[model samples]
Every structure is written in structure tokens, then in C-alpha cells.
Target: MSGLGQSGVTAVKWSAVSTLARFVLQLVAQIILARTLGPEIFGIFAIGMVVLTFATFFSGFGFSWSLLQRPTLCDEDVRFAWTWQLVVGLITMLGVYLLAPALSAYFREPRAQSVIEWLSIACLLSAAAAPSTYLLQRDLNFRAGGLIQVGSYMAGYVTVGVPMAILGWGATSLVAAWLVQAAVALVASYVVKPHAVRPLFWYADAASAVGTGRAVFLTNIVNWMLNNLDRVMIGRLLNAQALGLYNVAYNLAAMPNNLLLGALQPAFLAAGARLQGELDRLGRAYFQMLATIFVLVFPVFVFLALESNDLVHLLYGSKWSDAGSVLCILFLIMPAYVIWGLSTPVLWNTGRKYYESVLQLPILAIGALGFYFFAHQGLQAAATVAALVLVLRAVVVGTTAFRALKLSWIELLPDVGRGMILSALCAISVKAGQAAVSDYEMPLLSLAASTLTALGVLTLLLVIRPQILGVQSATMVIRFFPGMAQLLSRANPSTQRGPITNPVSEQRL
Candidate 1:
């Protein structure tokens, strides 16, 4: 393989490892914190986090992505990005601190004031790390990046968060955990790959970077709004407790996408940028990525939708049972969310960054209207409206992204369609299994039985027709033991009599 191809594969592997590790740690931490702190405290933290997350969109002024997407960079580019990040970080910190009172009053949660102020420290820490982190990405050194992330999460959640929660710190533990994570990441960025930190600035470099980032900045802003608007409206229209329940459901629903697709994003963006001149190759890679993502992530969402009640009860306890229906509603939108996420890198690489921001306008408007009208009804109703809006948004964005790549729905049907069909079948089987065991009183036993049945059915289907899941038997063997495939091919008498042939190799060639 070429250097870029090797680097891309390495990045993906490390990213996957990092994502899985972080997911496991966060899952444990959330379960512990939910049990200890309860929804009211989580609600308080959620309200504060909404403000903090919004300010984060501007903390780097989108320079991190600009640096990543840039074809080349010099010391001046690094310095310029660092300078802007620091400047914006300070500004955002102060802005959030000052706005804390207004945010607290808006959420009707007075505790938000202190939480926002404390969490603002994280913005500065993240800014400090941005330049180095981007440099690591630019160099395609995801191993270091992944290690930093996993270590930071461990330091934040396991070391700090769990202990603090045990000490009865309530919502403050969450904020403290975030600050520690940021600090660890900031320290690790320099330690892993030191970069010069100075006050140097060049207007031309800064302008170029800013110009490249302008659309990305707007897109991030709009995305942040689209994501958090419902939470904000819920916090305001309902109460912190309701927002807390909604936040848990939303997070659980979003976890698979965040874990799988999020891991793939950096690699995709970097690879897409490198292959920008080769449209055909880039388009093929993009489609393959979408297919791979669907195969990996779609089933998890389907399973979550089918067993939301059991999962909520088993993992989060009866206190959070109210989030079950909300989780089900959120799961309905995840496939669309995953598709939209997969297409984003394609759009970004093609210099269509503004398209996403523009497309989100209608979705945001519709979401806001829905939240306004339905939020008071309850969490499930609000989630239903949000899911409906998401489906519409997905259709529009997916069509636009496909057109930009000059790809047709038919081209993607084999990959994406198969996964959707299989996932649907898996869901139906699990549902049927659950009904067959309706007499079971234990949620845990029922959950295990349904999960096992789903897995068994899925495994049987794959064994019967591997291609339905986009995997052939030979391909699966080759993936694990590449040399064995070559050995087997050479040992075949027909191969010696004629030409050795591998359909998969021919297709790639």
C-alpha cells in the first residue's frame, strides 16, 4: 500500500480502538453518575453544558478543521491557528462567564450559573490543545491522538468523575470531570507532539485560515444549534428533570453513531482531502464508507429501538424508565443521522461546507416549531417531532450530498439497502422473541433472551447468504489471514493450469 493508504488504515484502526475504549468508560461513568446524582442534578449539568457546548463552537473559530483540511501548512499557519485559538478561547471564556446569569435565568435553574463558569475553563484548555492536535491529524498520526483521547477520558471519568460522584458532589462532579479531561488533553497534546506556542501572528496567514474556516464555522454553529435547541427549549419549557431524561435518551441513541462514525470521520476527511483530485476514486471510497457504516451501525440502532424499555431499565434503573419511549423515538432517527454524518466529509472535501449549514436552516426551523408546540406535551411527543424533522432533513441532505458526488441511489442500494433490510429483519425477530417470552417478569432475562435470539437469527442469515451483509466467506477469511488466501489460491491445481484469479482483487483493480 501507498503511504496515504497505509496511514488511512492506521488512523482508522487507532480511532476505532480509541472510540471503543472511550465508549466503554463513558458508559460505566454515566451509569454510576445517573444512579448517584439522579436526574435533577443531571438536568442542572445539562443546562449548563448547553451553554458551554455552544461557546465551544467558536472557541477555535473552526481553525482546527481548517488546519486539517488544508493541503499544506507551514510554521506560520500553525502559529496563526494557535494565536486565533488562544484569542478566541479567552473571549469565549469571558463571554460565557458573563452570560452565565442570563443562561441560568433562562433555564430557570440557578445552579447553572456556577456550572457554566466552571466549565468555561474547559474551553481555554481545549483551545490550548487545538494547534498540536490538528498537527497530529495533519501528520496522520492518529495513534498518538487516540492514546491522548483514551487517557484523557480515563483521567476525567474514571479517576475524577466516579470518585467525585461518590463523594456526593452532584452536578459539580460532571463539571470537574470535564475540566480534568480538558487539562489532561491539553498536557498530552504537547507531550505527545510538542509544537511551538508563541504570540506570533501574520494577517495574511490568519486571513487565509479564517477564510477557509468561515463556512465550517457557520456550519458548526448551525449544527450546534440544531442539536442543542431542543434541549434548550426543553430546559426552558419543561424543567431540568425532563431535560435530564431527554438528554440520557438522546445520548444513548446517539452513542453508536458517535462511536462508529465519529471514529471514521477524521480518517475520511484526511483521505478525502488527499484524494480530492481523483473524483472517481474519492466517490467510490465515499460510497464504500457509507456501506460499511450502515453495516456496522444500523443494526445497533434497530436493536436499541426494539429493546429501549428493557435497556433503559437494565442499564439505568427504574428511575429512568421514562426515558425508554424517548430513546425509542430517538433511535428512529439515528439511521438518518448516521447517513447525514457519513456524507458530511464528502461535502466538506468538495468545498460544499455551506450546503450543510443551509440545509439545516429548514430543519432547525421545523424543530423549533415542533418543540414550541409539542414540548409541553411531554418528552416522547417532543422526541417524535424531532425524529420526524430529522427524517426530512436526512432526505434533503442525503440527496444533495449524492448529487455533489454525482452518485445515484441505485449505486448505493446494494450496500445500504441490504443492511437496512437485514436490520429490519433482526428487529422483527427480536420483537417476536420478546412477545414469545412476555410471561417473563425479569427484565434482565428477557433482555438477554431477546438479544441472543436476535444475534442467532442474524448469524444464521449471514451464514446462509454472507453477501447480504456485504461479506463473502473468502473475503472474511482474507481479512483476518491475508497470507492464507494467497497460499490457498496458489495450491489450487486449476490456478496452476491457468491464471490465478481472485474476484475481489479484480474488482478492486
Candidate 2:
């Protein structure tokens, strides 16, 4: 395999394993916290975390992306990035401390101020780790990255989140968990791979990376605001209890997209950076990767949309009935986001960071404004607006991506066209079937039924119109699934090709 290909495979494997482990721990921790502290405390923590997450972009100073995208970063570049990250981290930490009171006042909760102040320390800790993590990613060192993530998550869960839940520390536990995770990461980075580069006091090389970094930072800030403003608004505008329910629902709805896209993103960016000048090759790779994302993600969203009510009721309880609408609407964002995310690495890695930022700003603005306009009404309104914004963002991003690849919408659409159609048809069928089945009233049953129906429909489509999935022939399937060769060979003769011939021989056959 090529370096990119091997890196992708390793990244995917480790990312999947890490994500599964992290999700399990997080889910268990959330469950314990929810049962112990209930909604009000949960709301406070969720809202505070949302704010901190937004501020985190400022702390990184865009160095992570600069480090990743640059073809030949030297020790001086690394040192410059690291030093600035420390400076930015300290400054942002102070800013957070000063801003906490105003934020608390905005949320009408005095307790939140302390939470914000405590969580601010995490900025410095995260800054300490960013260089190490960035180095791992730049080198395509998935093993190291995976180890760091898993260790940090485990530390957070065992030492802070879980213990705090047991002790009934409420929002304090959440803040503590944030601190623990960062602390673990910092310690791991220092001990695991100590850097020998001396820190640069001057900003010459740092200044060079700053422009691209700032654009990325700004884009990240806007993206964070657009994504999390609703939660922030909800915590302040609505009661903490309401915020808790809404937050949980939104998390559930967006989880699949977040996890899947999170895994794909770094590798995609790294791969795209390498393929910058190869437009035809880049476009083909982009489309195929996108198809792969859809194949994995579309069904999950469809299933969630179909079983939102059951899921909300089952996971969160009937007290959160208001969350059902939000879950359904937010599910719409997932598939669209998968498409949009695939284009971003292409845009940003090609040195079009500013262009990407320009494209992103309007979409985020629309989403943010849309959320603010209707969020006062309730979860349903907020979610609907969010969903619409996501769809619009996808359109904007897709158009931009096509233009960059020197192709039109029609050209790009054909490659992904069938997958989308199959997904839609499968979703519709699942929705209809779910409506008919009383099993959907129970969360587990409903989730299972919807999942099964969607999968079955997808399987039927894959079998009947296999060409739609780019697996038209048995040979293609075998090529994609080398491990399945033995099983596939058992198929009846009429359904199978006589033999896999060389391309030259096959042409003459």
C-alpha cells in the first residue's frame, strides 16, 4: 500500500477502536451522572462545556492545522507553533476567567461562573498537548494518537466524571472531567514523546503560520458557534431542566455524524494535502471517500429519524417528550454534513483556507441567525432551523467543492447520485414501516426495528441495483472485500463470473 493508503487503513482501524471505547465510557458516565444529578445539573454542565469548547479554538491558535498541512515543517516551525500556543492558551485562560461572570449572568446561574473559571485551566493543559498530537497526525502516527485519546478518556472517566457522579458533585464533576482529560493528555504527551526543540521567543516563523492558522481558527470559531449556539441559547433562554433534555437529544441525534466524521477528518486532510495538484485523481478519491462515508453514515441517520421518539423516551425518559422533535429534525443534518465534511479537507488542504472560511462564514451565519430567530419558541423550531441550515451548508459546500475540482454539479452528482437515492428510499421505507409497528413505542425495539428495516432496504438496493453502490459485479465485491473471497466462491454458478481474469485477458475474452 501507498503511505497514504496504509495511513488511512491504520487510522481507520485505531480510530474505530478508540471511538468505540470512548463512546462506551462516555455513555456510561452520562447515564450515571444523569441518574445521580438529574436534569438541572446536567444542563449547567452541558452549557458550560459548550462555551469552553468554543473558546478552545482560540487556544490552539491554528497551529495544529498549519503543522498538518505544511509539506516540510522544521524544528523551528514546531517550536514557534508550540510557544504561540502557550501564549494563546494563557491569554485565553485569563479571558475565560474574566468572562465567566458575564456568562453566568447571561445564563442566570451563579454556579456556572465557578465552573467556567475551573474549566479555563484546561486551555493551558490542552495547549501543552496540541503539539504532540499534531506531530503524531502529521507523521500519520495513528497508534500514538489512538493511545493518547483512549488514555485520556479512561482517565477522565475513572478519576473525575465517574467519581464526581458518585459523589454528586453536579456541574463540578463535569468541569473536573474536562480537567482530567486534558491533564492526562498533557502528561502522556510529555512522557511518551518528549520534544527536544527549544522554544522560540520570537514570532517570525510563527508569524508566517499565523495567517493560515488565524483563518482556520476563525473558521473553527464560526463553526463552533453555529453548532453550539443553540445549546447556549437554550441554557439561558429555557430552564436548566429543559436544556438538559434538549442537550441529550441533540447529542444522540448528532453522535453518528460526529464520531464517523471525526475519524475520517484527519486522514482525509492528510491524504488531500498530498494529492493537491492531481485534480482528476483528487476528484475521484474525494467522490469514492464520500461514497464510503455515506455507505456508513446514511443508514444511522435514517434509523435515528425513524425512531427518534422511542429513542428519546427510552434513553432519557418520558419526562423528555419535548426532545423528540429536535432529535428527528437534527437527524437531517447528519447525511448532509457527511457530504460537506468530505469537501472541507480538499478546500483547506489545497491552501484555500481563506476561501473555505469565506464559504463557511455565510452558512454559519445563516444557521446561527436561523437558530436565534426561532430558538425562543422551543426545541422543534430550533431543530428545524438547524436542519435547514445544515442542508443549505451542504449545498454551498458541494458547489464550492465541485468548482475547485474543475467539475460541475452534474458531473459530481452522478458519482454519489445513486447512494443518496438508495439512502432516501431506505429511510422512507423504514419510516413507513416504523409507523406501522407498535414495537417502535419501546426505545430498544423501535431502534432495533428501524435499524433492521433500513439495513434490509439498503441490502436489497445493493443486491438489486448493485451498480448504484459501485459494486456491480462479483469481482468488484471480491476486490473490496478480499476477506470474503472464500465465502463468495460458494455462490451458485449462474450468479458468479467463471474466473477472475487479468484486465488484458478479460478484454480479449
Candidate 3:
């Protein structure tokens, strides 16, 4: 009802729509690419992309966060940020190009050299578009951002990548597709919200911008390591095929976080920044975000974990069966990763920016030891270690974030304490359905039965006992569909534990 609430609703809608569209497009494209190119090719491209992705942070150096957190920005700051991005992109691109051979060699795929080299171009393209893309986020305008992402994916991956894979171009197809995606995004972003690209020639031109981004850059660097170290280890310690399988599994297990939480991130971050000084409002918003993830994302993750092998074969074909075991292991980290991700904006916006980077120091050391120990065993073992590290980091970081905001898990669990119970029930329903047809070779039928059974059980519970997810979550859900608010309330008073109330009601959003 308030201005912040209204814009946030629109932003949330657009962000969710865009991410859902992109997620669907990616799912279809990956399925096709997996069948057409197979694991070996994807593994090779993964090696290159992993490197480029890590270096990508430097290309913009978290300047986007720098933009968002700032209350005021002069033209010089924007131009400098753009110029800095372009220069760093070029440098990182060149570095990746030169190291392509070594990178490919490390992955035991000498043929990946050219692929990595070509993929380096994406760095430049994305860097060039940072100012424009981030400017939209800064303004809380996610419509153009969503449109750019979907249109780019369609133009690049769905339209280009799939065809090339079908034609047997291998990694070249992937490289080309990614470049095209970046190109399309670059062009579209600038066209929608143009920013000056002229070089400022001196860092002093935007000292405040540089100062703000320092910790964010460091934090992103460590976050990238936490996210990708397993893939790096898999590639180095195992082989291309193993890396390929793990990548696919990782993608599947992390999809919920990638799609839903990721989509909500920009909107939530911008909204939090607007109320950076309002501790109560920000903490309430944070709780709502966790609730949203628990209610919407946990079910999907549970289904994935419970039905990993069948789900893999159903979607990515039988060739990807090995990734199922790895996916099952990786599922342990999904909810934890969300906590880690959501905490970043809280830290950065609330002037606890450097605290995150510092926290990563011990966690990174622990993670490195775990990965080094388990990586040599096998993919599943490595995945197990990755999951442990993520959970640990989430606990540490999430606790720290809570304390920083003057909130605590014990205080907040009432809103989502029963989520684990709901997830457990859903998992049981899924397993029961699978067990009924365990002997049959009908993945589709089994999946359908499992899904329907789970949905039926969840719906029944929510209808009879809406308090299962607490009033806060129910209120948040209803806020997304205001018309249902009164209907649900009037339908049955006993259904909910407490009266539904907006967490952001008349607050600073």
C-alpha cells in the first residue's frame, strides 16, 4: 500500500517472471545440449566458463553493489565505474585467453583451449554492460532487466546453442552461444538505459565509488571460490567427464536458489537499501525472504533430493545418471546457500561489508581442507564436503548477519519452524509414490504420482492447518495475492495460528 511496498511488489513480480522464464529456457536448452553434445563437451566448456566466471567479478568489481548502496551518485562516478569495468574486463579477458592452454591442460582436456579463449570475450561484453544493467537495479526497475535476460537467452542459448549442439560443433557451440548471450544483453541493456563509457583517466575521479566497492569485490571473490572450488577440484583431480556430471548435478540441485532466490535478490537488496537505517523493517523483510525461500523453494529441493536419479533420467536423459548421486549429495547445500546469499546484501548495505570477507577467511580455509581431502575420493565424496562447507558457512554467516541486525534464529523460527516438517512430509509422499512403482521403468509415471501425492498432502495440510508455515509466511504469500487474503481469512479462522499481518505494513519497506 505504501510507495516502497508498491514498487517492491512490481519489482518482485518482474524479477520472478524473468528468472522463471530464464530458468525454463535454460532447462530446455540444457536438456537438448546434454543429449546432443553429451558430457565430455560440456565438461570442457565448464572448465573455461568457471575460470571466466571467477574473473568476471573483477571485471565489474562489485561496482553494481557500490551503485545500489549509494544515496547519491554524480555523473563522474557512473562514468568512472563504466570505465573501470571496461578496463578490467579487457584485462581479465586477456588473462583468460593467455592461460587457456594451462587451464585446459589442468582439466586434462587440451582441446578446451580454443573454447576457453573464445569464452573470454564474454568478460568484455558483460563488463561493458555493467553500468547500464546495474543502473536499472539501482532504480528498482526490473522490467527491462527481466526482458533483457529472457530475450538474450532466447537469442543465444535456445536459438543458437541448441542448434549448434545438434550440429555437433561441441564446445564451440557453447562458446558461441554464451558470447551471443552476453552480446545481446550488452546491446539491449545499453539501449534500454544507456550509460557513458568514456574513461575517467583517474581513480580519484570517483574515490567514494572505489571505496564502497572494495569490500564487495573481496567478498565476491571469496564467494566465487566457495561456489566453484568443487568444480575446479573435480576437473583437476578427476576428469572432463566427471566434471561434466558434477556440473550438471550442481546445476540441478542449485536451481531453486538460482531461479527463485536469485530473482528475488535484486528487488530485496534494493528494498533493504531503501530502509538501511530501519533495523526493525530490514530484519522483518529478511525474515520474510527466508520464509519465501522455505515455503516455495524447499519443496522443489526436497523433490530433487528424493528423486534425483529418476529426475535426472527424466530430464537430462540416462547418460546423466551418474550425476544423480552427486545431485543428491549437493542438495544438502541448497537452503544453506540461500542463507549465505541473502546475508550478503544485509552485510553490504548495513556497513558490515568487510565482516563478510573476514568471515570467509576461516571458512575458506576449512573448505579448502575439506575439498582437498574428499576430492581425491570421487565426485560424491567431493560433493559431500562441498555441502558440509556450505552448511557451516551458512551457519556462521547467517548467525553473524542475524546478530548484526539484532535478530536471532530462535526469535525468527516461529515463522518457518515447521518448514522442515512440511519438507519431511513431502519427501515421504514422494518416496511412497516412488516405492509403489519402484520395479517399473516408468520415470514419468512415477514422477507424476510422486508430485501429485506430495501436492495433495501439502494442500490438505495447509487448508486444514495454515499455521504449518506460520502466519508470517502466509501473510507474505497473501501479500503477493491480496484478493486471497480476505478469502483465506474468512474461509476458516482455525486454519491459521495467528491473524495474518504484513511484515512490511506501513514500514519503510
Q: Where does the lowest 10-residue lDDT sum fall in candidate 3? A: 490-499
Which numbered prediction scores highest in TM-score against the true structure? Answer: 3
User: Which stretches of candidate 1 lie above 4 Å from their native place?
Assistant: 1-4, 471-509
The order of the candidates by TM-score, greatest first, is: 3, 1, 2
Pairs of colliding residues, candidate 3: none
Summarize candidate 3's per-residue lDDT along 411-497 as a digit string, tens digits. 666545567788889899998888888788798888888988889998888777665765556666666777666545633356455
On the 0 to 100 scale, the lDDT of residue 12 in model 2 is 57
* Selected candidate, larger lDDT, 1 vs 3: 3
Clashing pairs in model 2, backbone N/Cα/C closer than 3 A: none
C-alpha root-mean-square deviation, each candidate = 3.9, 4.5, 2.3
Clash tally, candidates in order:
0, 0, 0
lDDT of each: 0.79, 0.71, 0.80
Per-candidate TM vs. native?
0.92, 0.88, 0.95
Error in Å for residue 58 of model 1: 1.6
Cα RMSD for predicted model 2: 4.5
